[model samples]
Target chain A: MPNGLDKPETTLEKIERMDRRIVFLAIAITIILPLIWPLGLPIGVSPQVDDFHEAIESIPDGSVVLFPNDYDPASKAELYPMTVAILHHFFKEDRNLKVIGLGLFPAGPPLLQKAFEEVAVDQYGAEYGKDFVNLGYKEGREIVMASMGESIPQTFPTDFFGTSIDSLPIMQGIKNYSDIAILVNVSAGYPGTKEWVQQVVSVFDVLMVSGTTGVSAPEYYPYYNSGQLAGMLEGLKGAAEYETLIEEQGIATSGMDAQSLGHLVIILFIIAGNVLFILNKRNKNRDRGGRF
Target chain B: MWELLGIWIQVFLTLAIFSFLYRDNPFYKFAEHLFVGVATGYWVVLQIRNVLIPNLFQPLFGEFSDPWLVIPLFLGLVLFMRLSDKYSYMSRWGMAAVVGIFSGLAIFGFGGGDLIIQIRSNVMPFIDTEAVQAFTQKAGVITFLNILSNPIFIIGVICVLFYFFFSTEHTGALGVVSKIGIYLLMISFGASYGNTVMARISLFIDRAQFGIVNWIPTVIIGILMIIAFVVLAITGKVDPKKQF
Candidate 1:
């Protein structure tokens, strides 16, 4: 009897023995290489992202917009760019944004602040407290949302900075959803885009838009189709599309080349992975006297 | 110069992180650890500022102060009590409070928002427009199918509810309907899984684009990663099946 390790390797053995880390590595390289030296692949704006832009653009200047940063660092890769692009549009158009954090994920507030500061808000003379106020993370997700729908000031007495909401110029007249022009929900998971739409938007009938991970996008499509959500930005592709739109208006087009290349590399890896699996499977089955 | 330097640092960090795609190695490990450390540090600071201070502390001292803050603060303190072996049982109170609050919130939210509204929305007529409604009414086939589907929808709801019944044995027509209900549930889950896979694949694609851009330094980093993979493979330091 031969030891298990010393036994002659079969095709099935090789197939089964294939390393998943290698696949991860392949995927990593495929993504990174493109980011570094982008192929500058052409990307078209999806209607979802386009509609989201149109909705925001239609909102009058100085209009109070409820902007929820309903995500964390885990989803930063996808949502961050979208956040920047949207903030550019809002700030450029001179719209007042009331940023809210629904997620208890502590990283949500500063991430939004950093993105806003980096993405043209500084140049556009966007001031905090006057132009925007971070409401921070409110405890009791759905309860707080319901409370917010009833009364914004009662739910969040102060902004994230511990400053009184009553003192903020932007938040002065904003009592509820009725007061806001539109809702821009950038969400990752639970207590996110869906929660806002269901708990607040549905009853208030507020015009709402969203930017969510690709995973969450399809679930929101029914709402979009139903006209409950005016528009949506779906994942990084949606972010890139929105970025492209912004850049065309001369905001952040340079980044799109990088974004497009990154997407292309990933598509290539998926193709490579599927090809390898098919090849490996065929070889194994042939050896096993099974038809491919 | 500093701004350009910051951009380069970002580019390097991005490259370092992406190096993991080729293989698990020291470079990837270093980057991963650095990210985890920085992220955790950032989170801890934010939690202190946002959740711990405002929700937990200010409520204790601020004008609208409440004694109830003590209850949550005590419960939260009990969570740290878990670090001590002798006081591990104390942590259960905190856990219970959290679980209870979350469960109550889920039921309340889901009942009012998801369950009621989804059903209401689906059952409601699609077209309120007179032209569309008149056309649909004139189309006898549409009216017949719509009428036939009403009972089917009711039957589906009953069957699905019955499928969850534990105390009683499903029998006769109920048993058949329950089985069909299980199949439908499974199909729904499978479709959800398919959608999730598609989303994850899109995410992976986004990451890959970072590495493949025309920048010279980035192209060099990509080459280095490949070389490192080959070196590790040649040295037999990594067993692909086990490591991956």
Candidate 2:
């Protein structure tokens, strides 16, 4: 029994060396099940997301909300839902609010256009170049934002369609950051919330919120704590929370049950990994006659 | 019909990329190469459409008294000089201008906003009553959690700062403080990892919804992939012993 090979392999040993494909398969099934079969999961709203919702609510009527739909297709799973929900909330018939949609990332516009079509066009029947203006993709990120503080028209001379900004009714009197009420940066990081903080919020003192990927959420807490960021919506959870606030059971809301189960799987793995590691370590130490 | 074709293409690509989870194969490589190529092609076309024509060409040819714009235009063009050995020196002119401008911009932007403001804000009351009030504004257990968390925040900040202090050796009280800092860092890292896991799961869920909701194309692709894998295994192209 003192020699490891003399004894049968323990359950720990067998499970520890199990092929990782099993875990992938497990995760795939758990996620796919919820997608196929609808589970009406009750979602709780987080304080940060509540703050983000309130920030939007606080935007005065007739004021413009600059929504920077700044992310690529890769982030579509998380950020795309947030974009749809936010647009749905913004273009609500009662609000009478205008939004200037733009992005630093090139891929963002097309996706934003999709959101516009789905939420703004179909649901709200919002007119193009009147209710919302897409500035397309700007190449310069921080520099472009900083320049935007000077003049929005100068920063972007034309709309997404190459139509002159002067002609678009939405662009009328929207000179700079000062004219804008609040900016919601739906970002998947760099040249996003951070850039907006530096170039616009810090410099021009623009009120802003950010809906970012889960990974970037921790870093923005300090900004949220400092009151620099008005609100924070982090990842799919944030999207679901925002959807809840808007009273819309969208894609993110449906994905919640799956997200929770996947998290449970990870937690189980982490606990198992630590427990097995410690036990195996002790066994190995005993075999070595107490040598570390 | 076009929409159906698009969906089929998308499903094929998704399955091709997803097959990598099983093992490395030509399908994954093809999808990867196609993605990179398409992305590069998109960026080039976008840059020309957005930048060259609208910002530079349209302005230069359309204007007479635009001396200010000409300087930037010349500097941008000179950046290509690096390709030629004889004119390589001219590239530095463009590079220097860029570096200098960015450096100046960043100094003010980052220094004043992120660094100065963040550091200043961190130096707050250890037990922030206002933050407690904000938490309490919303009902439930979060209020109690916020009350406990308010003090730990400042402590976490201090301990983490202490851990990074290499000028003085960590001994006595310093060691104890830095040791706490290590724990705080581990907690932060664990949170980050948890978030990353959630992100990855969400991505998988998105794809699952895409495929499962549109079951026809997905079923077709899934069968094809299984067949291809079976064929590869039978042909001895992918040695199972070597792979997994």
Candidate 3:
């Protein structure tokens, strides 16, 4: 193997010799720097995101929305922004909400509270048991989801902080999906948006919207096109775009600049990586008698 | 004072998790473990209050008590048998119940929502008056191509479904159609991959900005990291060839 300052190294030599730490550092910088000093780039809202916005927007005030936060902290980086944006839209539109969680992950309950509290502070003088209720996490994902759509209180008798559902103004007349206007699911993986669509939405004839991780987005496109899901927020980019729309409406727009620039920096890094890879391949092929 | 302390704890914990970007170390491990522990504890408490108490216990003992609750309660308890080797097989009943319920729900859901409804939605548009009216209005070179291509939509759907039909051999005209379907599927998959890469890269960019722009102190940390690597290399603590 040739050392640095010697003849160009073989691909195998580079792989064997390159420091793993360098790759780690590159990834770290690629993620962190843009977050700190954002470029505030423009992001066009996709039709999917717009559909999500319109679904929630079209629901009348005082209508019930069953929101399931089915993700943990690991996914917070991507899903949190979407949660905030959606909640802001919900609150701004004055919709009554019933929050439930399928105990897929432990962090889900508290994360839901934190996100709601962050957005609900300034809008509508929102009172806890009256405007919304957190039914907390339930076991048995499919069974619970199916039962809840049939009977809300049968699934959750009490709220998260130990309040009876009967006492909450929000639960007064909301019997099932028939009373509820829409089902908003902010999910990470299994027993998530897909499960909700299958077990609850399809059976009950409820409107459904989902915000899912990037990896899961493609799988859901068929459902989206079929009208099973009225709208979808696709990963962080979708979240960021949704955030932009919310902020433009004069809600939590303060963070848009930071989010936009972060996206631009990532796009630049991908371009740089591909360019370097192609150049290196060409140089190696030329030296190796035209063999790629 | 408590609020300030909480803020500090959160910030430090966030930084500790982020420190894994430099290298895997004790701080990162500690944060990871703590996160898992706290998260698990939170879920257990929530389940007791919302699920176990209300759905199972309340119905078993409270006003609306029913014998049906006992069945699920027993099954739920049997899941604990998983902890003992002798009783491990008992847990399968609970597992089978959950799997059976999920599978039934998934099949019904997919058939009603995805398969039937999707095909209906796509085909319904073609039969509508709007489509025919547009075809009639534009009856020229462009419109002729559009009208002629209408059948291709149904053909494309059939071809794509046929391409996945491993049970049958491709022969005659079906072979060419299936080949086209395979090409379309590949292009769609490639585009999806590009979207996924873009999403992951955005996450990477966000983290990079945090390390560099959040604090100037990271510069010194960066320098220390480089120096440590160089020293390890010089002192033979790390083999140059095995750096990865």
TM-score to native of every candidate shown: 0.70, 0.95, 0.79
User: What is the per-residue lDDT of model 3 for residues B68-183, given as tens digits with 9 covering 90 to 100?
Assistant: 87888788889999999999999999889988888887788778666677777667444446556777887677566556554666667777988988777887777887998888
Tell me the whole-model lDDT of each prediction, alpha carbons only. Answer: 0.69, 0.87, 0.70
What is candidate 2's lDDT per residue for A209-230, written digit by digit as tens?
A: 9999988888888889888899
Candidate 1: stretches off by over 4 Å: A1-47, A50-61, A95-104, A138-140, A150-166, A176-178, A202-205, A225-228, A243-292, B1-16, B62-68, B78-96, B124-243
- lDDT at residue B13 of model 3 (Cα atoms): 65
Top of the candidates by TM-score: 2
Worst 10 residues of 3 chain B by lDDT: B205-214
Docking class of 1: acceptable
Q: Model 2 reproduces what portion of true contacts?
A: 0.59
Q: DockQ, in order, for the candidates?
A: 0.23, 0.72, 0.41
lDDT of 3 by residue, A43-140 (tens): 77888999999898888766777888888766776777778778777777555544433234545777887766777755556667766667777677
TM-score rank, highest first?
2, 3, 1
Clash pairs for candidate 2? none
Off by over 4 Å in 2: A1-11, B63-67, B130-141, B241-244
lDDT of model 2, residue B28: 92
